[model samples]
Structure formats: C-alpha cells, structure tokens
Target: MKRLIVLLQVFLIGACLNKELTNDQELQKPIIQSPWVENPDEIGHDFYPRPQMKRANWENLNGFWDYAILPKGEKLPTLFDGQIRVPFAVESDLSGVLRKVGENQELWYRRSLSLNSLQDGKRFLLHFGGVDWESEVFVNGKSIGVHRGGYDPFSFDITPFIISDEDQELCIRVWDPSDQGPQPRGKQVNIPNSIWYTPVTGIWQTVWLEEVPEFYISSLKNTPDFDKKTIEVLAIISSESVADKVVVKALDEGMLVAETAVTPGEKAELKIQNPKQWSPKDPFLYDIEISLMQGDQELDKVYSYAALRKISQEVDENGIQRMMLNGEFLFQYGPLDQGWWPDGLYTAPNEEAMLFDILKTKEMGFNMIRKHVKVEPAQWYYHCDRLGMLVWQDMPNGDHGNVWEHRLGIVGKATDKQRSQESEQIYLNEWKAIIDANYNFPSIVVWVPFNEAWGQFNTKEVTEWTIDYDKTRLVNSASGGNFIMDGSKITGHMIDLHSYPEAVMPDPNIFGKDNILVLGEFGGLGLPIAGHTWQNEDNWGYQSFTDKEDLANRYKQLIDKLEELIQKGLSAAVYTQTTDVEIEVNGLMTYDRKVIKLDRDWLRSLHQKLYDLEIQINQ
Candidate 1:
C-alpha cells in the first residue's frame, strides 16, 4: 500500500508539470485568428500562383518549414526552433510561429522536397511568388541565387543544384528592415498603430517548382484593340536555337474562336469577329493557348487568357473630361481596398478569403476597387477579371523623405522630393516591373503611381513615362497626390482630391476641361463593433459612430453629398476602405471579416444612385 501511494504521487506530479507546459505553449501562440485558421493542409497555397501563365506539372513546396530567427550576422542555425507554415510571414498568426523578426535579426527557413523522374534536356525552375525584402535560396546545400523586391515574383533555375533523386534539402535566408529601409513596403511597420500595421518578414507567398523544356516561352503580352476587333499577342521566347514558328489560339467556352501563327518573337494578331467586350456588366474572357514549334514538332506549350476592353479619357455631353470604358462614359465607384488580413498580413488566408472582399465589393453595388498602396497576388487580380470588377492599382509607396502639404481645395503644384540616385532607381525599377507584370489583367483600368504625395518625386517625368509605357490604359499619375501643374493644366489623365468623413471632388470649374475630376478618397466612417476589432483600446476611424444604424445614416449623408458632386463633374470616387485593418476601424467589414458593418441591401440601394445618374445622362 505504501509503494502504490508513492507511485501515484509521482504520476500526479508528472501530470501537473505536463499541464503547465501545455498552458505555457498555448500562451505563446497567436491570439488573433481568422475564420479559416484551421490545421494547415499538407501543401499550403497549393493553388497555382500564376493563372495567366500555367503549365501542367508543377510541385507546391509550401507546407511545413523548419524556421529559426537569429541575429543579423549569425550563421544559419543547425537546429530550428519549430515548424512554421510556409507562404505566411513570421509575424502573421497563421504562420504557426507568430514571433516578430526584428530589423536586427535574420529569418531562415529549411525544408526538403522529393522529385520524380525528369525528362532529358528539361530544366527545373524554383519559383517564389513573393518574399518580403531580401532572400537567398539554396538547394541541396548549393547556393542558388538571391532576389530583392518584395512585391514581384522571381524564379531561379535549380536544375544544376538538384543533386539526387532522393529528398533534396532547400534553405532560404531572409532579411527585411521593413520601414527602417528605403524599400517600398507599403503600410508595414514594426509597431502597430492607427494606420500602419504588422511587418511581414521572409516568404509570404507561394513557393513552387516547375519543369519546362530547354526552349520555352518566357512571357505573353496581350493587347486588345476594340475598334479593330483583333487581339495582339507578343510571345517572348527564351531559346538558344531559333524556333521555327509560334502558334496562338483563342477559345471561347472550349470552341476555337480565333487562331494565328507568326514568327517566334513577333506579334501575332488573332482576329475575332464580333468580339464580346469585357465590362463590369459582361466580363467575358477568352482562354488562350500558345505553342513554340520547331518545324512539325512542338517544343513547349502554355495556357493563358485575355479579355477585350479599352479605357480612355474623353469629353462628355456636359463638356467635362470623363473616364470612358469600352467607348462609353461610365462612372466608377468602389472602396479603397488596402488588401490586409488579420490572420495573413500580406496574403489572404485562402483564395476564398481573397475573393470574399471582391465579391462583397460587388455585392455592395460598387463597380470598382482602388487597390490602395499595396499589390495583391496574381490570383486576386484573376478573381477581379472573372467577376467583372474594375480596378485602379496603386504603386506601393516608399522613401518618405519629403514633407507633404495638403492642398485639397487650392491648386497645388507638385512637391518634388529630391530623392537620391539609388532611391529613384529602385522606385523606377519596381514600378516598371509591377506594371509589366500586371499588364495582362483586364480589370485594371487605371495605374495610380503616387498616393497623397507619399514618396512623390519626378511627377511630370513619371507621368509621361507611364503614358508612354502603356497607352492602353489611362494613368492617374498622382491619385490625391501633389498635382503637377503647367500654368492651368494639371499633368495626368485625372485631377483628384481627398476629403475625410464626407465625399469631395477636385474643383471642376478650375480644371474640368483638361482632366477627369475624381474623389480619389473620402468618407472614412468608423464603427468598431465589439469582438471584431484588432484591439479594443485604440480602435478608431475618420468619423466614429456607436451603432450600425448611425453609421449607415452618416454614410447615406456622405453619398448624398457625393451624388451632388457627380452632377458637378465627378467621374469616379473611392470610399475610404473595404475592411478594417489593425486599429483603423473605417472598413465596411471588420478586420477579421466576421461582420459587415452596414446593412448590405441598404448600402447597395444607396450606391445604385450614382450609376442611375450615369444611365439617365447617357439616355
């Protein structure tokens, strides 16, 4: 009996210690989470990152990765702290290791991937959809290469680094200074605040591997000429030997609508008879197939897509410069989408979560969305294209060395920040790459280069360059940015102004003839619902309200003012935001995407007024 009692005591002590350890582990976990935060799949972000350019066989390398955070100068740790979910930043809750990687620390990730037998002369490429600031990749302990620029997709040829058919080790080292550096990191910051939120370090997007032929098509540039009823495609091929020809095909619902053949590197014009125009009402997309052929044999084949659309600036019946879509003067209205998530900082929890925002924007009767300050995944744009939503994409801002003087009502000249040669080069390179990368999306109608003068520089020159680069789309060089003026002319396609709590527009009487007048940003109405906020203490908005009823009333009043401005000459308007982010509670939906602040039916009814006016005017 004494021995049995002693054994029971020991068992009880061990149980208590185990319980304490479990509690401590729970405490270390992330508190805030999204609705989709379940056990991660074997391959996270398994969906094809590039829908525009897709191949049949590719491996998703995005499940669990051994991670370690060490001092900036420290070598790679032999042992890892724990397993973290790939494609999620260290600071994000869904990463499984919600720890801050400070500016002084380097984040490392290690994993192993097994490969199947590959065809002879084929090359294997490791692709990263995006990584925060800087990344160095290694395969089988062999250094592959490094890539910078957080918002762009990059790939490296890993054929030479793959040493064995067995599991090969993959390692990545990342360093991100966030706001400390001069990189264009959007709204990421170390400390959370009213507007700025968490910093995303290391890989925050899909990592995959693709096997392709030695000679392959590198990229496709599709441009639709609405008047000519022809789609022009430029297939860029990378090959050591000259390819015989390139074949392009456009299909509608599986039937071939148009097909053409041209020289490998030249442009192929595929003529479509009675091409269905892509618009917010009827978003029609034609599936495309491109093949690189050597005489009678096909070397490589890729699947792509395109839409027939056009955007331009023209004088309407009211003698005002109006933004025209598909040769018609249509008013665009939507929310200013920041594209941040509570669970996933830069990435959405899943494709559904990403599509939810766009779907909700449409459900709320908004025809457009101004992607504010940040870029989203390629699939996000794909959703927009298919769902028939207009997009105005902003170039992520960086290098804030100049003071911005708001000249909302007054005629403001461009505030030129004399950026260093290096800073200017970085900005220019990234901006150009972003444009080139996203050029194929049909939903993007406008390219906003600067926002409210955040890192504004060389306004006139940049505006001209953008116009020259892609004449297919209109350029709002500075959306609510410092208006660059030449006497009476504000240089750019649009003249925009931002007002808080209520809607306002650029003075039509002053600059109505030359530029399209728009309310780039306005009506940041805030109502923080308890239990749905990022934090209870410091949650805020431009105009705070206690209840949903009061918030809706205030929003209705703002729309009434906006309707009055529409008659005065406003062509488009972007409401403050789509969802609450961090402490700023001005979103139509909560940060966790749990609640819609206002009644959707009522909001939609109110928004229909703007489109009704456009229809009446056109009639």
Candidate 2:
C-alpha cells in the first residue's frame, strides 16, 4: 500500500506539470497585459472570494477549463474549441479565446474533479461567485440546476451526484444577451464605443468547492450601532435537526472582548466597552467567530469581522443640511469609480492589480468612491474596509425603453420609466440580493438604485423599500439622473445633479433645507495619452485638453468652484472617474493604469482645499 501511494503521488505531480504547459501553449496572448500577467500561477483570481463568512476547508476551481462556443439551443459538444481561463470572460483578452459569444450563441465549460478530496459523510457545495446572465449546471451529464441573475452569487449541493470511486465530470452552459436582453448588465455592449464597453459573457469570478457538515452556517448579517456601543449579529443556519446553540465571539487584536451564546437563527447582541469607531482616517475592525453547536460538540464554525459606526444627515450650526459621519458633519468627495479593466474586462488580472486602483485612489487624497453602476467582488469591499475608504455602491442597470432627457439646465422633476411587471420583479429581486450579500461591509455608506434614467421605474416605491429594508445606510434613489418628485419636492435623502466639464450643485435656496445637496457627477475633463487610449481616433471626453499642465490647472479651477458650492451647502461630490474606460478619456488615470494623466502632488494639494472646508464646517 505504501508503494502504491508513492506511485499515485508521482503521477498526480506529472499530470499537473503537463496541464500547466498545455494551458500556456493553448491560450491566446493578450493584446495588452498587466504587470502580473507574466506568471502562469497568477493568471486567475485564486483568493477566497467570500471573506465575511469563511471556513477552513475549500478548493479553488479556477485555472484552465475546456471551452466551446456553439449556436444557441444546441446540445453540448463532445469536442471543445480550446482551453479558456476560468473567471475571465470569453471576449476578454485574458480568457485565451478572444472570441465574442453573441446573443445567438452559448458558451460551454467542462472540467473533471477527483472525489478523493472529499471526506467521508461530508457534503460538498459548489459555488460560483458570479456568472453572467443565465447559467445551467450539469454533473455526469445529469442536470443539476439553473440560475438567472448575473451579478449575484449562486451555489449548488452536488454531493449526491458524485460517484465515489470515479472522477466527477462537471459542465456548465451560459447565455448572456447583454444589452439585447432585459437583464441587469452594466455598461456592456456588443459594439464597444464612447461610454459603453465590451460585453462579458460566462463566468467572470472565482469558482470553488467547499466541504461542510450536514448542518452548517449559511449566512450572517452584522449591523453596528455606535450610540449603543453594541454589534448586532444574525446568523442563518441550515440543518435537518435543530442546532442546540450558537456561540458568538468578538475579538480585538486576537484578545476576546465580548462573547455570547444564543439559539440558532436568533439575533445576538454583543456589547463592547468603548468600542473603536470606523472612519476613513482610522478604520478599526473587530474580528468575530461563530460556531454551530449541538450539546458540547461543534458542528461548524465561521469567521467574520465588523465595525462600529453610524451615517446620518442633520442640520448644522450654519442652518444647512450636512452629511454626518459618526456624529460630526463631513464633506464627502471622491471619484465616480467604474470598476473595469483593459485585459480582463470585468475581472482584474490579479489581486495585486485590483488593490493598485484602491491604493492609488487613496494616494490621490480621496476618502470615498461612488462605485458607478456596477457591483464588484467582495474582496474589493474588504480592502476598502481594512484600508479605510468609504463606498457608495450602485445597482447594475438594464432594460431601458424610456428616453433620457439630459436636461443640463433644467431643475424640475423627470418622469420615471414605465416597465413591465416582469422587468420590475427582476430588478427588485437582484437589487435585494445585492444589498443582502453586501450588508456586512462597513465601507458601504450609501445604496444607489438608478443611474441617470437608464432603467428607472417605480422610483418612489423602490426608494422607500430600500430605506425600510436597511435603515443603517443612506439611499440615493437616483444619482444625477431622474428625480421622482413628491409634488414640487424631490424624493430620497439627497438632491443630486449632474454637470459636465465642471462642478455644479442644486440651488440651495430651493432644495437646501429639506435635502442634502450634492454634485453626483461633474468634471469629465479629457486628456488621452497617445499609447494608453483604447482607440486613437474616436476617443473623447466631456471637455478636451492637451497637456498635463493644462489638465491640472483646469481641475484646480473646478475644485475652486466646488469649494464655493460647499459654502452654499453642497454636502458631497463625485468627480468624473478614477480611471479611463474604453474610449472615454475623462479619468484621472489612463485605461491601462500605466499613466497618471495629471500631476499627483498638484492634484492632492487641490483636493486638500475641499477637505479643509469640512474643518471649517466643524469649527
């Protein structure tokens, strides 16, 4: 038996080496590669996707998978076109197959898994962090299940379908109509241009398998209350038999600060003495551990973390409404971050590449980012929580039939789009799932439901529901887009307006007393570097500039105007973007992230002027 085990180990090592060589030779070279793309081991996103609920036993199913693109409604083909990298969209250069799977086609993926990794009497869960549009799963040619939403995570229990002695065959079918369908696809279009980008089809995130007990912890919701100095935790457990009890622990730098035992599915309130508050300047998080118990035996355990903070709006000493962080008024200013990549499309080339953007944003003297019309992997938010950056997350937009009047000078209310019942339900379901999945991240301070007028419908009802569902965060019903008016007054918590080429805010005299005025978007100044642009000819910006000195000077002028608006009760502002996307050259950085379009020190000094005004407000 010892000799047999030695022989098996050798064979497995040889197989992995052979597979690596094949992957390198079979995949297509990317047109433009990031710094981390040279190494084969760093090709896919291999980190643990879910950080809020983490366990010890899991396997990453990223690397290479056999892929074939065939006509729609066709049966699975026995022969594959080639090997494509998992988690990168098929149309992306990193996928090793830069081929478009259009509305009339379907993308297929196949991989083989060994069941020897599974322990006896343990259930195996297959998880897909994200798959675009529609997906169907199959094991050993038997159908498992189907999922429709594109931006949310989905999982399946595949223990029963596995054969104990033989290797398991896993296959997936994905169909994404992109902009042609009513599904929520943000900025993806068939023909990429100006603001629209290349469509991402099939899996674009981490795919993995996890081992769990028959009864295990499914999910967790953490809400922090600074006034009460307590953290509320709600753990959802799955089981056939009722769990005897649940143990929750709060640790500060590895020392136990608070702990409690409660019944399964019950809310547990853990109190701490003089808890550290979380803010952009000092982000302190308390680690948490939860375990499902039966008598004295522990069935399962998961790790998480939370912060103690509060966000609200109130009247200041100057009699102007201001956005407050913790308890004091703060002037929020940041870029409109559209999370996209040149090589990987929807997915970043590597974890380091993803962190570079957030770090650079901070280095540029910004404290927050409005994640414009897109949701990112949980790890992105995790970095924000640890590194201390506030986030205003937007729901992905889709299904547009109404005409969006870009009434730049007009201030009256805009009409909401009339969507069918099916479209409305789809939008609501996905929005709720997104909010629930990301509720624990402390960096997220605002939930933005609509952008401009692109799929806006039933604005009043949706905004009210979002506020009711999660009272901890503020809700921006529409960002610089449409305004659902309650008679003459605008709905939602903030009055947002969009202006191009410069900063502008709503007239404080008309909307100041009731709502916090904000310049949701402005200053899309364009400066396209020769080699860094997506295209040389058609690239454009809201206002075009030539040299770095000119861009810096123009941006400073915009900041000067913004300071004046702040004096007029502008509570927050979001600049055009953090990075240039596609043919739009209005970003602080170029598309490839290789160049900063303007002077960094000069820009930081200019931004300091905005932050200085916040100090004056407090004084």
| Strongest candidate by lDDT | 2
TM-score of candidate 2 versus the correct structure, residues matched by position: 0.93
What is the alpha-carbon RMSD of candidate 2 to the true structure?
11.3
Error of 2 at 524 (Å): 1.1
* Candidate 1 lDDT, 1-619, residue by residue in tens: 9999999999889866743342113213434556776655522566899999999878888878999888787766789989988899887777888777756778999998788765686888898888988899988777789877888888998877776557888999998887777778889766555677778888999999988888988888999898788889999987664678999999999999999999888899989977899999999999999999989899999999999999988876667788888888788999999998888888888887888899999999999999998888899999999999999999998888776665775765446898889888878988888898899999999999998888899989999899999989998978877888855788888988888977888777788888999989998999888888877677899999999888888899998988898888889999989998888999999988889988788889998888888522332
Number of backbone collisions per candidate, in order?
0, 0
Taking all chains together, each candidate's TM-score versus the true structure is 0.93, 0.93
Per-residue lDDT of model 2, residues 535-561, tens digit only: 667789899998888888888899999
Q: Local error of candidate 2 at 104, Å?
A: 1.1
Clashing pairs in 2: none
Give lDDT for model 2.
0.86
Please list the C-alpha lDDT of all candidates, in the order they appear.
0.85, 0.86
